[model samples]
Target: MHSLETVILLLVFVLGLALLAQRIHLVFPILLTVGGLVIGFIPGLPRVVLDPSVVLLVFLPPILYSAAWYTNWSDFRQYVEPVIVLALGLVLVTSLGVALLAHSIIPGFTVSMGLLLGAIISPSDAVAATTIMKTQSVPRKIVTILEGESLVNDASALVLLQLALTSVTTGAFSLENALLEFVILSVGGIGTGLALGFISFCIHKHAKLEPALETVLTFVTAYLAYLVAEHLHLSGVLSVVTAGLFIGHKQSRVHSPIVRMQAVAVWDFVIVLLNGLIFILIGLQLPHVVNAIRGQSADYLCVYGIGISLAVVVIRFVYIFMADTVSNQIRSLIHRAPIFPSRRYTTLLAYISMRGIVSLAAVLSIPEKLPNGSPFPGRNLILFITFCVILFTLVVQGILLPLVIRALAFGQPSTDYLSRHEVQKQLSQRALRQVQRLIDQDKLTGIAVQAVIAQHQMRVRELANAETAPLLDQHQLNQKLMLTSIQAQRDELINLRDRQQIDIELFHEMENELDRQEIQWHPVSG
Candidate 1:
């Protein structure tokens, strides 16, 4: 077991590197990964041999939940077709193409082994994609599609991987059975997640706990969705995502002001730290993977890794283009809307293949030996190739994506904030009108209306006049000022902790309160 001090030291290193990454305006995951590689080669530092189980249990649920929580359901539904095609169809195509290539090129690799490897690398990491996209001037629609794709693709890939692994172990493969199982598990996971979400909502509604307890209950909801789904042999990833989406959709109606206030801050804290550690863990495992590849010649390994990486990249372009052509042609024949396939956006989407620690965890989860006690076929080569593909995609594709965007002259930034804020302001006015109706009916006093609706009136007026002001996130003009003050207070608290005027525990509690306040104040559009 790793000691407490070792874990703390690793985290401290991650923190320092994170600051450096921000200072240089580099993506945090990229730089932190490189930092990890550097530390991995050093002789004296303790080897951070992370278990596959740890990453699965600790990192996966929170990371998936965070993405699902922030995903806007309306946008998801509107773009359901494309999201499903990419998340479901593209995953299958990529896996099959990789499997075919691996089975053909690599010596002594079975179809099942190839399938397992393909599934391991198929799911694109949106965190890595977003890190790249955020630095560039990508279009908002492309970003949104990539984000939505990343949220649910793991379910498709993982389920496929499990089936392939079972095939490899049992020396049998059944396509019809796999499809039926996929349907059952996927549907069951969705049902389980929605049921769990309902249970959480009811618990929060009836328990009437304080914000702290409610926050804990929300965490419980997330873990339960994953664990219970897995216990029932369903897709745990999908379950957690489904639950997160359900709760996020109903959040405003169900959660109290205080619960809403605390949940975001708590989740933010959990996700960032968890993600940072996983990246560092990714970096730390480089040596172990490199060592494991000694069973094969380096030349063969490099050729296979680089060849399959290029093939997968090429396959994505082909599949997307084919999907676009086929969908558009069918839609035209049926006299319906086009597939909304922008050439430039499609090109950008094709480049969002940066895999992350998830890939590593999945690859590591492969067993060392098969059921009959013989070593798992091509296991070492799979490990090395998985590592190589991840690094190449993360570094090469990640760094070049922005340059490509610039080349296409399509890096212009856009936001829907102003339009959404205008809509919100309009709704607030209608609400004011409703209040006026109540006053006219003598149900509410006019004086009371004026007192209660001053903020609403100010917001509408500010939005009306703000054609010149740089658009901020909220409809209310004062939101920026409030955020600035909250940030200043947060800094002050950190400074106090640094100066040792407060203990770390006290500092965290006070800082979390400020964080909760900050989150609660952030503008949301319906």
Candidate 2:
């Protein structure tokens, strides 16, 4: 089949599997991956080769940007300590542990090759963990830490991977040099990202571009941050992440409402497409990787795969416990209060160590040949093992995460709804007072004054009732009834269009107006 035809078919497969996943209440990534695997094994199907550069250059920047963009900056800052432990310390530990295991298990594997494999699988995928957490009421702090870890760990892992690859090519290793390089790259990447973000902000401030162009510029900023950092031999992953965080934080202040809304919609659509395609591509690589290492015994492959996967998982679990203990000890020494995450949160964190597409991309990007013109040592094996780890964790751990959360009941009962309600009530009361003050100051007595005061008073009353009732308040009840009525009107509008009683343009205009109304009323909590 033609390449375009193959892509179209794969997109169809993505949609179909996504729908199936929704129907079955399974995480879509797992099902999409399995679907891709099945499709890959079909007889005479076109081989869809995954280009590593395409992944690193094209898909990664936007995906990472979107994740960083949506992250709650305040929560991330508050959980910075644990995020560092997981993103940096735990990743290094996992890499070293996996390095030892890979070196011992694979006959010809070097320490550098082992480390390369280790780094490839070190960072857990944020999307997989967060997607599962969204379905459950996981604690806000846990979610923030996980997101922060996922954002920062990619840079650490990728940097280590680069160092390992260099060591393999040179047949030399130096810890002091590697550490120095790591610091330099990290600092440089961060600086570049911030600088680019500031520049983008300036452009938005001065240019006054249309919403569509502004949305386009946000994507441009992401790609530019990655490309510029990579060109300068810095950590492009960190650069993209940093730029995203900076831009995301400033967006509310710098961007107009229409731009923000449009950018969000565009980014959401793109991220979904990219995420689905990425997991499917990861699955589709299975056959090719298996073929690359075909001569190995089935039992041998199984042992290697299982052993490595187990090593990564167990290493993380142990590290989380060790790190938390050590953290508490240090806090005690410094006379600071301990037990922020608690034991339960630590256990949940350990369970969320599922690897995903970044691992696959890192492993697949291994050089086909070394400087000596020899094929890179253990390249095929590394790819195969990475796939196994991702599959094992994603299927086994991802499936069990929600059940574990329910069993533990670790999520806190959030007060965000009540807080929003309180704020709304206060605002409405303030507005009413302001209107009365303005009317008295101007010595005005007319229909306009009565209209403004009445609107504000009504809002305050409704909000006050909502607070008192807490659940199913008069405001909420009215919201539901209003929505039901709107739905009936929507049905009638469609029927009118079907009967040719309304022109297409008029129908579309009315549809958009209804959409705006729905958006306005949907947030009935406040």
lDDT leader: 2
Q: What is candidate 1's TM-score against the reference?
A: 0.83
The runs of at least 3 residues in candidate 1 whose Cα sits more than 4 Å from the true structure, single-residue gaps closed, are 135-137, 371-375, 411-424, 427-431, 434-459, 467-526
Q: Which stretches of candidate 2 lie over 4 Å from their true place?
A: 411-418, 426-449, 467-526
**lDDT tens digits by residue: candidate 1, 1-526:** 3589888987898789889988987787677567766787777776666554445667777778777876767667767888899999998998998999999998778888899999989988887677666667877667667778888788788878878888888989888998999898899989999999899878877787877888898888889998999899998878988998887766645565456656777898787677667666656666776787655777887899999889878888998888888988999999988755367777778867887767776777777678788987777688778877877788788778778888867745554333434433443455455544545666544443454456445655776776332322333444444454445545554444334343332444554555555555763411
What's the number of clashes in each of the models? 0, 0
Tens digit of lDDT per residue, candidate 2, span 1-526?
Answer: 8888977877887888889998998887677656756776777766677665556787878988888886656557766899998999988999999989888988888888888899999988877778888778777567767888998898889888889889988999999999999998899999999999999989987788987899999999999999999899998888999999888866655665456667878998887777677667766766776888857997899899999999998999999998888989999999988746478878888888888777866876777788789987778888878878888998888888889999878656452222445544543455456556656776867554555456556677878788442222224434433354345445555455444344333444555555555556674211
Worst 10 residues of 1 by lDDT: 467-476
How many steric clashes does model 1 contain?
0
